[model samples]
Target: MTHVLNRIILTAILALFAVQANAMWIQPDWYEVTQPGVGTNRYAYSGNDPINNFDPLGNDFSKAPGDYDFSEEGAAREEAEMQNRDLDGVTDGIIIDKSIGHLSSGPGRYRSTQKYLEAVASGKIGPQNSEISRKEALANIRDLGEQFEQRSLVCDASCEAMVPGPGQTSAIGASVAVVGGVAAGTNSIPTRGKFKGSTPGTSPASIAARQAFGNTRIPGNVRLPAPTAKAPLQTSNRVGTVVGRIGPIGAVVGGAIVGTQVIRRDSQVLQCMSSCYSTGFLDR
Candidate 1:
């Protein structure tokens, strides 16, 4: 009994070590992000006071040099005539140029905002030479997913990172059997016992003999062919890990494994990063 227990424990330990060995190293990339016109004058609007809250929707015409409310008829006619006189000096007096006004300036701001989004998508936010390579960014995010796993970042109430692995599948199967056996108490118990004999590259008689007696080979009589090499192990090394960078941007730790897959699999990554950034944890 002690020997069997020892073997089980040893197997469990080995399985654990194997799992850890395959784990991706996820760490946060603290490198600052860079984008054109970010925190610079190109993004700034000329003649717009940054210190004051200028409301274009407000009725105040104080900032609008050409617009004035004239209550008196004489004043209103004189202002209109003066404005027309100013237009007469232009080369094309009949053509009214609206772009010279401040109202058209808002579109430039809108364009700058679009450029910002484009920069983010292209991963070119900082100085021309300053940036993490796409490969390194991917590698880093995978590591973050592993870190999230270790930190117990639960997705919904049940799922963590979807670590698809042979061991986890085996564990889940064993769990199901254990639960079902306790619940049903059917003839499946015998079928459960037969599962151990289901190893590859074994004969039916040998399986039967193994099932009947603990050992397979009859010591002196029939010799069996040697087993082939162990199958290459599969692990959850590709599981995605996300880490935040810049203000809202995030990096992946093991990007090489799951980088291309994350956007397709989970659209919630952006939401996750947004939440993490709001709480000021993802940057860490």
Candidate 2:
């Protein structure tokens, strides 16, 4: 019994380490953001902490570079080897711009701000740069990150700095959820004893609910393949999106045709009546 208890304790410690390992990193290429701009420059998503944030369709307009066209051969070549795959330049720029803006805009704290600005003043670093330059660049970013944390400047109305937007928060939440789910499954009672062969008394919904909510992977809990259903589902979604747009257009065309036909029919009837009256048909 003592040996079994020791093993259990050891297993728990190991599992905890795994959870911490998985929880450290955030999603790389996305930002949870809200910024002020023209109506045309708005992002697709908006929210603050926890639940309401979303990713934009493309780059944020404020975070865009003046000459930042990615179509050039040189730009593509550079992008192929960036630290963050999709938003490398944007990420670096946000850090630099925010550091500058935040530091310059404040009324006091000139000393710390100047130190940070001097650290970042030597120009940005790229993957193609020398080892010494890369290290120095990393050191600069680290200093700025420390300052951001010290001042709690990560999120602002214009969240354009080295902050975790909704995207990163979601990633962190998902990671934690995954760890919790997996841990829950390991200690779940329903996943044990008679769950392996023939489920005698369990309803399908209850079993499915256990598997989904409890994150269990018990034996005989296999999912059937449905390859043919995917295309139809996608097509249905597209049709739904287009239906409203097509409705008004179809209405306009049908109305025009009906109006023209009615006008022509009325004109013909009027002409016949006039001719009949002229030919004395009514008196006959």
Candidate 3:
């Protein structure tokens, strides 16, 4: 019985040894291993181990040539894209040359559609960064002109809206747009017409203002508003002419004539227009 028990114990010990030898050993937490050289630790390339030259725990400790070359190539490519970035100044709308990574590399219309649109909206960007058509640049100016028109919409009086008043006080033309978006002041445009020298109903104060600023001329591209009906004036204030002082009885007749004709003629149709609009009677 003693011999049998000893034999079983010996077999159990041998089996345990065999199992231990066959079992697979686990890696000692890969990061725990010392690096091969003086650099960032190496782990499997993945999100957890990002590439960073200065990162103490950065991976790719070998400094592989492929990684270095790739970074350099990427930078060079971006620089090239920047150099070629711009809207196509040639508006022929033909792609004579092929584009490289959204670059306006050729003489085509608007290579980078987004950049061109931004340049068109804002005149600040130049051809180095973006290109826009001359029409598009002018359209930007026109957009500014529309903004001016919208601003003019806020003007309460006909004169303020660029409608000629009943007198020599020249009303400014509507929506003056200049090249480069640098526009002249509205006060520069005159309300004077052919009849202004004759039957103008200018107030003395207005005439003084005109005389004060008579030197400046209106800029081009500003469409002169057509003539509108003048507002009725009191007998004492009939267009700076003191009809009461001239002839009291004649003043009433003149006032009646003004109210019946000039004052009541085309207020709505020519609210912001004038009577001497030779191009057309419809002030629009």
Candidate 4:
């Protein structure tokens, strides 16, 4: 009986050793062939510690529960920060360009007008027997008036205050824009059609109406009275004047509002960064 018991125990021990050796030599179900060093070792599993470590896919060991993947998180955060920096750079460039353009445009227009007038006065170009033909002269005069119209569109105080600088409130910018718009509007009404001594009644429609009425004669030697040169309700001159005055104000106000929103968004981003730093979510 004792000999039989010993043989049974010896067989069980040999089977246990065989199972352990087989498990040690067994290859993983999958291998990370693309990886560098350990990829060649098909039998290596979870850094050769199958007791404490596990790799179900056989490519990489799974992290313990509650472990944070700082590398991936950090990479994602870095990408986001880079994009934000790029956006900020673009925004700043646009703002600077806008500021410079606004500051230079009014003076540039004035200088152009001065040069044109000087040329006309010097007889280099004029309606008289000068360099240009009569048709060209008329076109040049019309272009000059159009230039004046363009000048009126932007030659206002709002152009200066529409873009607020750092630490400025949108309300202040909007208020300044509104005030400037009102001033421009008020100045434009009286000078609507008075481009270089031209009068409001000198519009083409008014002139045509006057001429038609003046030449019209009734039967039996009766003459029709010439009508006064009054502008129609929806004349181009009237509408242009109204729109030119109102458009700038609206533009300025809209710019102020948009600038305010951008500022708020930037501030929020800053606040988020600050909070993240305080909570140890970001490094200084």
Best by lDDT: 4
Worst 10 residues of 2 by lDDT: 44-53
> 163-245 in candidate 4: lDDT tens per residue?
43445456545544554354344433334445311344443333333343344333355322222224233223232232233
lDDT of 3 by residue, 101-206 (tens): 1222221112133233444445444445544544565554455335433432332233334533343211111111111011112222344543231233342323
Look at candidate 1 and tell me the lDDT of residue 194: 53
TM-score to native of every candidate shown: 0.15, 0.19, 0.16, 0.18
Which residue ranges in model 2 land beyond 4 Å of their true spot? 1-63, 67-143, 151-284
Q: How accurate locally, in lDDT, is each candidate?
A: 0.27, 0.29, 0.29, 0.32
Poorest stretch of ten by lDDT in candidate 4: 99-108
lDDT of 2: 0.29
**Once model 3 is optimally superposed onto the true structure by TM-score, how far is the C-alpha of residue 200 displaced, in angstroms?**
33
lDDT of 1 at 161: 38
- Which ten-residue region of model 3 has the weakest summed lDDT? 171-180
Candidate 1 has what TM-score?
A: 0.15
Clashes of each: 18, 2, 15, 0
lDDT of 4 at 30: 22
Candidate 2: tens digits of C-alpha lDDT, residues 20-60:
22322111122222323322211111111110111122234
* lDDT for residue 39 in candidate 1, whole number 0-100: 27
